[model samples]
Target: MKYLIVHDAAPGQFIHIYKHLRSEGHEVVVASRRGTTHRLPVKQLVYELPEELKGSRSGYTAKVIGLGLSLYEELKPLAFDGWAPDVILSHASRGASYFLRDLFPRARIVSLFEWYYGAPNPDTGMDEGAFRQQAANAAATNMPISRDFDCMDAGYTPTLFQRDAFPKSWHRNLEVIHDGIDTDFYTPANKRAIEVNGKRFRKGDEIVTYAARGMEHTRGFVEFMAAISEVQKRRPDLQVLIAAADRLCYDPGEKGKGLKSFVDETIDYDRERTHFLGLVPEAKFVSVLQVSSLHVYLTKPFVLSWSLLNAMSVGIPVLGSASAPVQEVISNGDNGLLVSMDDGQALADAMDHLLADQVEAGRLGRAGRETVIERYGLAQCLQRQLDLMRG
Candidate 1:
């Protein structure tokens, strides 16, 4: 089968899916707004749009209007290129869906439901009033796309969650497939342990952790920092490494700036204990996970990040918040630990327990890796996508 996979950018998860489809002997083409310069295995088709539509904008209204027109203009020529698609899989909702449908009407349209408007906690990068209005508009845009599509697919979220967020009637078509991990790529390696500054870590050095970008209040960065501080009070040996690409947001000097409101000022973080190594390469990132004893993944009631899954794949036992997708994946005291989203004390306690119990932590990490291999491996996900297309 020939598949056209569309996403805003080449999300690592979607790229894995694209590769999976290709390995199964299916012709896959990936469409993105940004030009493809990276060495991804699949065929890439870049959708060029106007300069105004590309930059960081204030409201969703302008973006929606710009996206709709830009997509129409960009995809108009694909209809006559003799590049007929058997299925059109997309994320970011209607823009890609509508464009692909116009190009190939008979193709099965399977959209990955990463989010819906009324979900418990959404990542709206704006004020409350503005966010609500934008969310309503986005919901309005998505409704028609869902109605028109033949199938809707979700990676981690359950059917009930999707139904609750969207119109209840559309639940019948929703497919809940576990987004798989490449066990081989993420497996534990025997590389020399390195510290945050690339120095060799000593045999018994303590390394507490957090990994994510845009350290906003909603993303649980502040809470994680507080938790680390609390944990460090009792276990003074522990050092926290906050690994991410954008370090400017977390800097105290950049407060009150645009999007910097997400940063919290109350927490008095220790500079020496808290090391922010702004975005290392992928190989080094994975190495950090392998070397670290405990990994803390915190989020509000939002979508599960691919990073958490990758952590699991790499055999790092995670202490995550009991939110929607985290709760869905992690069973407390089983594969990994789950703590309350808001309670810094609880998070700190969980961290302390995991750090103290080396045997238990190792067991959890091994079990977590096994779970990924058995249930959420890349092969299983690929077969599921094939089944959806065949159906």
Candidate 2:
């Protein structure tokens, strides 16, 4: 089958599937804006957007709606180039193929959606920003994506939490499939020592791991820091290994300040014991997890992080936020432990308990690894995605 991917410059959501498709003799073409399209193994048709279409007072969804039209315009010649695609896959948040329905009328278009958000964000389900007062803005914010979705042949969400976030009317139309974890690559390994920024952590080190977690409110970074610091007070030998960009991706902060500095100013943690590896490579990250006594993941009611699954795949005990999304993956005291997103004391207690009780931690770690292998295996995810593309 011929496949065409519409995406932004960053590595796409279906990268592995596309590479596998190419390996299996399927022709794939990616029409993307200029960032990281070079990573794809398939042919690519890159386009540049006009300056004005690049950004606006509106959010990324709005910006992409404008950019999608430009992409459609750029690909107009493909209608006569004899490079017709059997299916089109795109990230709904990114600029996708819009206004090309007439050109590729026979092509099946599928949009991959993550979680949905509105004025009164689910994280702060407070009295402020009532849906009624913000209804118009919210609808307009969602209008472009909704309109594009209406024209799709199928909609896909990686989790049931995400699918259910869509209107109840669209639930039946969307299917849940995980992006999957490479168990073979992420599995536990025995190591004598791992080094990061000149600090070497050995097998006996009581390392607490956090990964790909920006210092933001949504990820509950503040809570994690506080909880871990409390644990540190009790366990003086405990060391923290964090791998993430110091920037805030989901929350607005003061200009010229990374959340690391903000977090330092607000939260009191042992700086000497904490090693900020600021987004380490995959090898280093896995090594960190392999030596970890416990891994901590905290998030609001938002899209779940792949790092959480990666840590689990490494057979490490995970203490995650008890939000709906995290709860879906972690069964407290079974596969993994969880506490309320904002309950700093609860998070600290869980961390301390898991770190102290190695036997119980090992059991949870093994169960967590079993869960990932059974449910989110890489082979199974690829097969399901291949089926989606075929349809």
Candidate 3:
């Protein structure tokens, strides 16, 4: 089968699935905007918008209209070059290809749906003020996207939580298949000592870890820091390691300061005990999890983070926010523990419990890895995706 994947950026977890398709002798081509397209093991076509469509209110509006046209225009040359695709897959947010159905009338077009926001959302369900108003306004931005989706052949989402976020009408075409984790690579290892800043941490050291793409309120950075201070009051021997960019991604306003600023304002914990590894390499991250006594992950009612699954795959006990998305993966007292995102005291208590009970922690950690191996294995996810694409 010939495949044409349309994305705003490079293939992320789809890289593994792409390789598998190529290995099976299927031809694949990627039409991307900002990725190392030449470096990927596939034919590539590039599309880009003018530089003016960047970083302003008017620019954002121009980008939305211009990007769709640019993507469609770039692919016209490919069609002229005699490269016909059997299927077209694209991110739902990139509504460009929704207009190109006439060009590939025979090909099935699948939208890789992620989030669909509207009023009364889970993210603002507990809100009492401006958050609710902001979320409702944000949902209006999806009007054009919802109209474009009407022309899609099918839709696929990584989770039921995300799938349900869309209108109930589209649920029939939307299927849930997570971007799986590589269990073999993420499995527990007895790395006897992990060195950080010239200090070696042996097996028995009490280490606590919090990792994310960014230190944002959506990930509960403030709550995590407050809990850390409370936890330190009880166990000053605990060593903390935070791995994330120091800025916000979802909400980038001045009020959305980094974790350090939050810590500086609210907490008085010993700075010497905490280490901010500010987005380290994969090897270093895995080493941190391997040596960790407990791994804490907090998030609003948004998409589940892959870091949570990665930590679980490494066989470490995770204490995650008791939100819908996180709750879907973690079963309390089974694979991992869940703490109320609104309760700082409960967060500290859960962390202390998991860190103190080594026997129970080990049991939960093993179960967590088993969950990943059984349900979210990479090979299984790839096959499931292929099946959806074939349909």
Candidate 4:
């Protein structure tokens, strides 16, 4: 079937889903504002937004109303040229769904619900009033998407956490199918000898911790740092390797920015135990996981990170935050260990325990790999998506 997917096209969740749909033999077209220059394997249809609309304020009420008209005007011609679509799958909520429905009256329009308003902002320090206003705008804008649910053929979400976030009435057409991982690319490997940044790391010597692009409050970077310090105090020989995409570089004098500089000032950097390698290739990331003795993944109650799942696929013992999506995947003391969201001591203790007991860690890692193979593998996810579309 021909499918048109509208999303931000950032280097995260949506990209994997895009690639997966293409691999399943669907004629996929991505409508995105970012990564215009980045080459993708499938057919891509770009939508350019004005600078004002693409800014952080675009989610506001006035800004969305203005941008909605502009987006409709820009995408009309592309929809005609593409011969319309069999199904228009959108992650951009109401605006894109409404525009697509107007353009392709015959096509089934499905929206992927990654988030909803009214939920607590996982990011700390966000002004409540501003956040509430953003939510209000989102609710207003997303009405079109929700309204189309009955008219459209079907809708799908990656997790139950996302589905339950919406009102029960709106989720009538929603189906929960996980955005799965490619097991071949992220399979279990022997942690013998691995190198990062020209430094050789042995299996038991290095402990790799990871967080992605946004190092903001939502990702629990501060808590990860605190946990690292706690672990270091006990195990002085531990070498912490941090692999991140967007490393926060803050001004030294900023009082309460909640930036990376704040972490630098609080932690004892002189020990030289922590190394931050900014944005390595995918192969290198898999290699880091292969050689890691223990991997710490901390986050607030947001969408689960793909890295954690990738690590699990590779049979690396993961210590993740006990939040919604993460908790759904990790069963404490089973496949992987789960710790409280802001509990630094618990995170540190779990890390130390996993590291000290290699036998138990190996067992958990093996179990995690089995779970990925049995349930969350690419084949299973592909079949589920096909079923969703066919239904």
Candidate 5:
């Protein structure tokens, strides 16, 4: 079978399937924005909008359409060479492959959606200005995603929570199949002293870890720090390690400003104990988790992050926000603990409780690892993706 993979970037989550198809003697091609994948067949796509068309900041919808059209122009050569794929697995882009349908009419296009950005978190009371910004953001991001959904033969989301976020009409076409984690790579490590970024993190050290792609409001960084502040007052020996860059992934309010401006200015942080290892390598990230007494993850009903699962896979007790996507994975007091993101004192209390109760923490850690192995393990998910891509 001829399988084509379309993504804003690849072989991201699709790496396992991409390698599998080639080893199985199937014709596979990847089209993405990356420059090269060494031996793998790929058509690198890059299109810069003309400066003359960069007139208004209000024309975000038009700008996104240009990006989609650019993707189509870059990918037509594959079809021109009489190499139309039987299936296309497109991921996380605003109709990047929607125009490809004209060339590969027979191919089944399955778009992988992380989440449909429907509305801002209900708890976050929006003023008139905030409401207008939310609407504009939707136009720039969600509008294009809606276009992709309209053209896809099927939609695949990682979790049921994410699937349910889409319009009710799309539910029939949507399927939930997580791009799973590598169990072997992310396994329970032997507890020991590990040195990272010139800091020696010793075993038995009271350390709390927080990780995300960036330090932003959406990831609950501000609230995490607030909780951390409370925990600091309780545990004098506790050390905090944050593994993310100072930037915004979501939350446009924090974009132009940085970590200094993004986080709540009033939260009293234990700056001496707090270490911000800005965007460490994956191996280092694992080291941080390995030394962690407790791992904290939070999201505002947004796309589920891999760091949370990675910490779980690493066999550490994790505390996640009680948001829809997180609640889907963590069973409070069982596999993992959960807290309302709005309640900073409650979060701090949970962290303090976990730290004090090592026996319960260990149990939760083991259960969390078991959850990952059984549900989101790579072996099963890879097979499912292979079937979909080869269909």
Candidate 6:
């Protein structure tokens, strides 16, 4: 079957699936933003908005509209080609592939729906402010995509919590299938150590790890810094290994300040005990997890991060926030410990508790790994994706 995948940026999970499909002798075509190396059959397309509409300060809706228009113009040529797809998988919520229906009317179209924004949700409360108001209004951008929903055969989301974010009418069309983790590759080591600044961490060291794509309010970056300070007061022997950029990827309203600003003002700890490794390689990242006595992951009621599952798969105990996406994965005191996102003292206590008892930590970590193997294994997830596409 000829399968066409459309996305603004090449989705990582889909790229893996594309390779799997090719191995099974299926024709797969990926159209996305240029300069991404997918190692597959891809048509690179770059869409640039007019100079007048190009600015970071532009409204969210305006930007989406501009992107849709630009992408439509760039991809319109594909319709003229003799190549026709039997199925189309689009990662769009801003009408990026709404025009594909006109080109391939007979093809079964599916949307890989990641998120649908609404007001007063987990990310933002009922705080009266311009930013909050804008976030609330941002839900209107889904209208264009919603109008085109009937044209789509189905919608796929990684988690049920994420799938529920869309309109009630769309829930029936939505399927909950996670982009699973590779348990065999992310397995824990019998003995693993990593060197930071000439000091090597042994298997018995009290190493705590915190990681994210970026440090910002959404991920509870400031709260983590405060919690680490508290953890230091109790366990001076504890060493923190953080993996993230110093700047904010998600706008937290502030312009110049980031985690660095919070560290300078709040965190007071010996330089030797704290290490900020800015985005280490994947192999090195796995080494950090191997040496970790405990791992902390926090986020608002948003998307479930792959890092959390990967850390769990590494067989290290995790202390995650008791939020929607996290609660779905972690059961308190069973597989992992769940703490409040706002409670720094609680976070510190959880870290200390896990560090103090290696036996209990090991038990939880083993259970966490088992959970990933059972529920989020790559083979099971890939099979589900194949089933969805075949339908």
| Candidate 5 local lDDT, residue 271 | 76
Which lDDT value does model 4 have at 127?
80
Lowest lDDT sum, 10 consecutive residues, model 3, at 249-258
**lDDT tens per residue, model 2, 109-199:** 8878886656665456644545454555456556656765787888788899888888889888887888888899899877647887788
Candidate 4 ranges beyond 4 A from true positions: 10-26, 35-37, 41-43, 51-59, 65-71, 78-82, 119-152, 191-193, 247-258, 269-271
For all the candidates, what are their Cα RMSDs to the real structure?
4.7, 2.8, 3.1, 4.3, 2.7, 2.9
Candidate 6 lDDT, 1-391, residue by residue in tens: 8888777666555766777877988777776654543445555556544566667677656766676677677656766766678988888566567567777888898778877766554454445676566565566667556745777887789999998888887888888999888788888987887888788997778889999878788888888888888888899799999998787755534444457666767677656788989888878988888888899999998888888999999999999999999999999999999999998889889888999988999999999999999999999998898889888
Candidate 5 collision pairs = none
Collision count for each candidate, in order: 0, 1, 0, 0, 0, 0
Which prediction has more favorable TM-score, 1 or 2?
2
Estimated TM-score per prediction?
0.81, 0.91, 0.89, 0.84, 0.90, 0.89
Q: Which stretches in model 6 have alpha-carbon errors above 4 Å? A: 34-42, 56-59, 121-132, 144-148, 197-199, 251-257
Give candidate 2's error at residue 54 in angstroms.
4.0
- The ten-residue window of minimal lDDT in model 4 covers 248-257
lDDT (Cα atoms) of all candidates against the true structure: 0.67, 0.79, 0.79, 0.70, 0.80, 0.80
Q: For candidate 5, write residues 193-276 as lDDT tens digits.
A: 776557788757999999987877889999899889999999999999999888877776535444645454677888788888
- Any idea what lDDT model 5 has? 0.80
Task: Report the candidate with higher lDDT, 3 versus 4.
Answer: 3
Two-way TM-score contest, 1 vs 4, winner: 4
Which residue ranges in model 3 land beyond 4 Å of their true spot? 35-38, 59-61, 94-98, 120-137, 252-259
Residue 321 lDDT, candidate 5, scale 0-100: 97
Model 2 segments more than 4 A misplaced: 36-38, 55-62, 121-137, 252-257
Q: How far does residue 185 in candidate 4 sit from its true spot (Å)?
A: 1.6
Residue clash pairs of candidate 6: none
Ranking by TM-score: 2, 5, 6, 3, 4, 1
